[model samples]
Target: MDKASVDYTLYLVTDSTMIPANKTFLDQVSQAIDNGVTLVQLREKSLLTLDFINRAKETLQLCRKKGIPLIINDRVDVALAVDADGVHVGQDDMPATLVRKLIGPDKILGLSCGIPLEMEKAIEEGVVDYVGFGAMFPTKTKKDIKLDRFGQGPIGIRRLLRTLEKHNSSSERKIKCVAIGGINQSNAAKVLYQLNTPTQKVDGLAVVSCIMAAPDAAKATKDLIQIIHTPAPWTQALTITKEEPQSLENKIKTVTAKSPLVHHITNGVVKNFSANVTLAIGASPIMSEFGDEYEEFASTIDNICLVLNIGTPSPEMMNLFKHALQTYNKYGRMILLDPVACGATQARLNVVKELLNYGQVNVIKGNIGEISGILKLTSTYKQANGNEEEVLMKGVDSIAQLNEDDIISTGKQVSKDFKVVVVISGPINYVIHQDRYKSIPGGHPLMGTVTGTGCSLGSTIGSFIGAQADGRNKDKFDVYEAVIGAVELYNKAGREAAEEAKGSGTFMVKFIDKLFENTHNI
Candidate 1:
């Protein structure tokens, strides 16, 4: 088989230990290929040389009969004896040059790459046909990943791909990329979609338990193929703007008409205020952090939105946030993340990183300091010198000494990298999507004097997003417009409330009253 013609989509790496009790290993492999798997890799690490060769010969016969390419995992001798189509080896295994020499040029060559240096070496060696980038999530299959660096997930994959571009820009033989380890039905789409950036692309996914360990391998393979071919429900309906956008009043009206359920898993400090703000915006509010109910709530509720605020970063709260994030992603629901004081402590920063790595977030709103912290996580941010500049956090409030231009720029990069709407809230707020951004400059300084105002803004945005879940016309439900409309409405309300209030206490009441007027009109 020609290496270039091989289809890498839905690659199945076989593991006999994970096969179902009712089915034999070859039966699962045969069923998976008959359904949708494009390629197969025979990996029998526990077997003796003779047994491994026998198994590889059998697997190769099944793959050849189905016209699917077969790859041997780290056993070149077995592959040669069986005349397998390819061989895959890890960095710690035999080097790629020797593997290519041993396997010769006609057979395919795959390398396991975990970091940028490994990818750079593969590009320089120019012998690898494809590279598997993983342990995308923590899984029992890959026991070699002991450090956090290897467990960087999708974000790490993006970085490694970007590194490839830097080293091999004009090469005609572009190395195909595959994500392996811990990629299952729930996160397979996310891993594939998140890595599909403008600069980087992941060709396919390599799986073990998703198909091999399934009760019915054929059905599992078919379902995964459908998922790969069909577009994810959450990835569509995005509004991209190159110029100034039109009025989003229609989007606002969608919220009032639908009255979408907005779930808030926020901190204790601003629970009541956030709920009131949600209600005032013509959306139903439910503040529940009980992790047990997330799956039911996400699956049953139509057009539901979750506002996940990390103000109180307890271990319990962090775990709940991860559960809620994954549930929302699985159900194609919108989620607004508020990483409160993300740069204030290392613990909080680590919590936010895990959440971003876990699921797809629709909208992320934070002050300049918090947004700056997110920007630093990506490769887009550059320091003035080699040293890292400190961003001060005054107990959930930002005192980061940055100009408005810097904030807007950071918001743009964060939005582009994460593929979400970013709101950098302050006196002059910026709502940014891929390449476009809208600046709303109306909020009063006194709004910051009140507690929970920023947190309430997240609730308002989430309400608008929930309302955008109109099944009538999913294309018309633009999350970008909803987010921009929400920020504009929230800021306008703050400006109006500040003019009518007597003090900070009165300002909070007036802010709610302003939002309440919108509900009456709706």
Candidate 2:
């Protein structure tokens, strides 16, 4: 098979050890191909050399007949012996340079890479056609898995893709990328979607048990292909349009009319203010940290939105937050995550990462320091000094200094990385969604004097996004526009309230009043 005539999407890596009792391995492979598996990898780690070569030749016949490439995993000799389409080698396997020389330029060459440096060396040698990134989640298939190198999940994969992009900038050929290890129907969509960015994306997914071990491989393959082709509900709903955005008054009118139920699993200090802000925006608020009620709240409620604040990120609270997040994700409900004081403590950073991986988040709102912290979570992020500067915090407030340009760029990167709307709270607030971004430059100095204004802004966003969930506004639901509307309303209200307030105490009251007046005026 020619290397150029390869489709890397939906790669099936065979593992007969896990195959079902009644199922023959070849039948399953054929079934997967009959459905939509575009590539195949024969990976029998324990089979004898003769047995391995025999299996490779048989699989090659099936693959060639189906017009799909068959890759021999970690066995260049077997691949050459059977004249297979490709050989996929791991970091510990024989050198790729030798493998390429043996296979020649016409056949495909794949590599299993977990680190940027490993990929860097491969790109330097110019001996690889594609790379497999992961061991993304925990799996029983590979027992000797190195958790340190392999379990970094999408964070690790993102770093690897950035490395490929860095090389692609000057290289003649763009290398293909495929994510492997523990991918299944449950996570394939999130994995592919989360790993994709505006600049780069994973070319395909490689799986073992999802297709190979299934009792009916065709149905399994069809389900996975369907998921890959269909956009996730939230992702589909948030697609940016070329037309002009709706008027701010009309956006606020949707919120008041729908009054989305904003569920706040937030900190102790901000509960009252967050709820008051929710009410002021004409949304119902339910402040519940009780983990037991999360299912009913997420599954039963209509026109619901979840606002997750990491202010009180105790171990127990984090568990509850994750449960609520997953429940909301299961129902395809909207979520707004406030990583409060995320850069201030290691514990908070850990919690934010956990929440990010646990479920799909529609929006992430934070200050410049917190957003900078989120940017640092990606291994490739670097500042001008080529060192990650610490985000200093006094109590829950960030003393980390970042200019406006830095804030906008940081917000943009975070939005791209997490696949969520990013709102960076600053003097000039910035809201970013995919390729679209807006800079809203209004808000009074007194807004900084308040304690829960930032947290309450999350509540406001929850209200607007909740309205987007309403069937009444189904034709008008645009999360990017809704988030833009929320930030502008909050900032403008802060400016108006600051004009009428005597001090911080009165500014807080007037801010709520302004939210009510402004939202109701529509």
Candidate 3:
């Protein structure tokens, strides 16, 4: 069989120890093949050489009978003895070039790559037929394997997408990638969809215990195949619905009545403003940044919503943010990220990237410059001399030239990339969730004059999200509606405050009062 003709959709790497005591290893393999597994690799490390060769021959025959390719794992001698279709080697195993030379030209060779650089090396050397990219998630199957030696540890969906991006840009020949490690029916859809961008996607899913340890291997295989092919509910494009004024008012009433706890692990610079904004919008605010206290709030607080702001980040603060985000995600709660000045420094950008990559952020709220920085867009501004100066974000301020289409496109792309609602704040606020986007177009210029308004806005959104959770409206919570309502409410309060205030200082106070008044009236 030719390597190019192989169908790797559901690659199975056999671990006989994981099979049920009642079922033979061959029986499970046959059932999985009957269901939908497209490829198989016989991996036996503890068996004696002769015993391994015998098992390889038997497995190869079974696979050939089913017209499926069986590859040997880390045992080129056994693969040669059995004349197996291929051999898969790990990073520390026989080098791909040497393996190719030993196996000769017609036989297949699969190299396990943990990082993009290794993948690049494989393509550059032109030695392997395919690459196995993983451990995409923590796996008990390969618990003893030291992943750090390979320069990656469970490269999550985001990192996997990045590795694939690097590979596509550098190599002209298409190299098939089969994702291994911790892939199961529960997370197969996410591994397939979330790991994919508009341009890059994994060609197949490689499994160990998911099928090997299953009571019903056929059913497990069938179920995994189904999930891999079907679109996750969250990934589907939702249409924007026009929200009525009455509906918005009712949502506000729910917030006041419930007063859900909105936890802010924000910067010290904006902690007071964020907490006040949360309270004024009819939500209980808890300003806590200690990682030690995260478990208490995550466990005890009801209808909890977390706001993670990177306005003043330290390694300790970033660690706390990670803890909070993981806790919220574990409880299936909402988390809003305010990436303040993410593009200002390499440290800030790295911290934000780490948070986004690790956490399942539900909402990302930032100004044009911050959002552009997070998305890595080349944003520029007009200088006093009427020349375009590349915007190097200095503080938590937006000095970039604003283009409506560019902002909208960036918002949409970021939303899709993270599978999260993105709110880009400016003169026109864009609330984007998947395909649906709405622009809330009014805010007093005085709003920008106040410090931490952006952080406060994120806090306000967190309050609404918490309220929605309390109202038992999570499944029904319209992300676009919630964002639009938050922006509209804040904008209206700013406009009212501007009318009554003499200056930015007075406007800040009036704005808080207006928020309370609006909530009370609703």
Candidate 4:
């Protein structure tokens, strides 16, 4: 088999033991290949040498019929006996260099890498064609291997990306990299998109149980390929505008016409304000913190959006937040997370981290302190010399005056890491969705004098996102645009409300009224 003819996009490794009692191993492999599996590996660790060779021979004939490559795993003798397309070796198996010597250069050789150092060594040695990197997530198939040896648990997507970078910098020849272990349809998109950087990314995904254990192997393979090929949601850049745009007015109308239900499980202090903000934006509001009601709301509500704020954190509230997040995920509804005062305490940070890890959050609204805390950057404050001087944040407020570059970088990193639109609140609001970022640069200073404004902004954004979910604009729905419109509208209302305000109390009252009045003409 020729190396150029092989497609590594959906690499399938066979585990005969996981095959159903009703089905033969070859039946599953044939089904997977018929659907979209580009490559296959015969991994028979427990079988006798001759038996494994015979199995490989049969599988090779099947793969050759379909024009797909069949590589034997760990057994070079079996691969050589059957004249298999190539052989895949693990770290403890025959040295890749020796395997390369045994098998001619025409065959495809893949090495399983557990960490960056191993990958670097393989590339420097230049013995293999591609690298199989994983235990991307925990898996029963490779349960015997020590996870800690691979770096943090599961060799998470972020770390895998870093390893790729290291490989690129160290090696001149380009080699394909595949993600293996515990990958499935549910997390296929995350594994493909999250483990990607501007300079480097994995060429394909390798699976054990996901393709082998699935009842419908063909459908599973097709679905995984679809996720791998789907365009990333954040590819479009965030664009900013200064004028009173027609798009903003149109989105506001959509919200009013649809009357989307904006559900809130926010802090006790901001419940009233957040609900009013939702209502002001022409969306119905529901405030509930009871975990028991989540299933009811999820089942009943049609045009729904959820807002989760972690300002006032408690164990009970955390449970409710998790419940709502999971329910909304199932319904495919947009969820807005407001990690208010996230940097103020360890408890708040822990809650924010858990929610981010558990759900596919649509948008995350936070202050500078909160966003920086979430990214785990060095906490610093601006000195009198207009420089970012290092200082630990002891309170909730932001002490450092971050420039546009700093804010944009932080926002993009957060958006990429969590696959959500990140909104950092300040006098100049910065909104980032994937690779694009928009900085809306107008708001009254007095808006900062009040509490719950940030929480309210999240509710407002939720309303706009819910309105966009009506399928009429599903393909055109860009969360960055929706959030920019929401921010511009809210900021304009704040400027208008400040014109006739006497003090903080008057400004707060006027701001809510102005938000309601402006929605009519937005």
- Name the TM-score of candidate 1: 0.94
Query: Which residue pairs in candidate 2 collide?
Result: none
Residue 49 lDDT (model 4): 88
**lDDT tens per residue, model 2, 242-348:** 66677888788888888789999888988999899999989999998777877887677767889999887787887788788767876678899999888887667
For candidate 3, write residues 1-522 as lDDT tens digits: 877788989999999888898899989998898899999999998999999998888887788878999999999999999899989999899999999999998888898876555765787888788888877766776654434321222223345446556667677766777888877775566567556666677888999898989999999999988877776543332234454433567668778877889888877878888888888988999987667877777677756789888878887887788778767755556788988887566667667766765566778998888877666521111111232224647677777775788888778777876778899888888898877787887578888888888789998888877666222343455656666677778888888989999999999999999999988875
Model number with the top TM-score: 1
lDDT per residue (tens digit) for residues 238-328 in model 1: 5543334445566567788888888999989999988899889888999997888888998998868999999888888878888888888
Candidate 4 TM-score to native: 0.79
Task: For candidate 1, list the clashing residue pairs, or say none.
Answer: none
The better-scoring model by TM-score among 1 and 4 is 1
lDDT of each: 0.83, 0.83, 0.76, 0.75
Better candidate number, 2 or 3, judged by lDDT: 2
Judge candidate 1 at residue 410 and give its lDDT.
Answer: 83
How far does residue 129 in candidate 2 sit from its true spot (Å)?
Answer: 1.6
Q: How many residue-pair clashes does candidate 4 contain?
A: 1
